[model samples]
Target: MKNEPIYLDQEENELLNEIENGEWVSNPLSPQERQAYQNNAKYTKSLQEKRQTTIRFSVSDLAVIKAKSKEMGIGYQNLIQALVHNYAVGKIKLEA
Candidate 1:
């Protein structure tokens, strides 16, 4: 994808502003520092551990989920995971 700037969310604009402000400037990382950064990044990501599972959904339902996720600026998988987690924690409820 082209790095051409596109108007997106607040975060994207904030990143651009940070770049313009030279907030992203940093001293070159030494080999050890680079290694440490990589290790820490891996560890941090591991804390967000994931499990693979499968579920069946109707085509129309899946489409709606995908569309809603896009509208919310998140991937469908993340949106579904958040929804399920919220429901499990009683943050969301079904009313009939």
Candidate 2:
């Protein structure tokens, strides 16, 4: 005999279908999962060291960069270095 369609109240049925289809995924990480990810990230980030360097830029460009740095909550020098490094590694795209 064919099985009867499961009659679930709205809330139960809504999630029930997703559970069966394997599409239901947790939106946020649990505390243990979050801690594991954080530990791995901390180690990865710690593997790098800061190096000091200097370069010249146009006055207006420096002013704009400083303003952008303030907006991004980082120092102007750090922002410039990040932009240069990202460009060098091809992680960031520059539009013509």
Candidate 3:
């Protein structure tokens, strides 16, 4: 039996139209470039893996963190994680 044509969502149909209009260009990756991208993806995934650990915070610090996190519309743990990540990636720095 022949299958009926699948319908495209609005976004998908727009993408198809763009391709048909030559708005999208194809740039095939070389084997070395592909391997580099795969390695980068694996490293990124490794960085994203979470591990649990205990940390002792002062009552005042904890309160401030919670207040700031609330203002930012995120949990304090997420703010902490972002801070740590930024430090690790050199986006944040500490004075000696």
Backbone atom clashes (below 3 Å) for every candidate: 0, 0, 0
lDDT of 3 by residue, 1-96 (tens): 379888999999988998999897778999999999999999999987889999999999999999999999999999999998999999999999
Cα deviation of 65 in candidate 2 (Å)? 0.3
List per-prediction Cα lDDT, in the order shown: 0.92, 0.90, 0.95
Candidate 2 lDDT for residue 31: 100
Model 2, range 3-40, lDDT digits (tens) per residue? 87757899898799899999898799999999999999
* TM-score, cand. 1: 0.48
- Model 1 agreement with the true structure over 1-96: per-residue lDDT tens digits: 699866779988887888999897657999999999999999999978988999999999999999999999999999999999999889999999
TM-score against native, each model: 0.48, 0.44, 0.53
Best by TM-score: 3
lDDT score at residue 92, model 2, on the 0-100 scale: 97
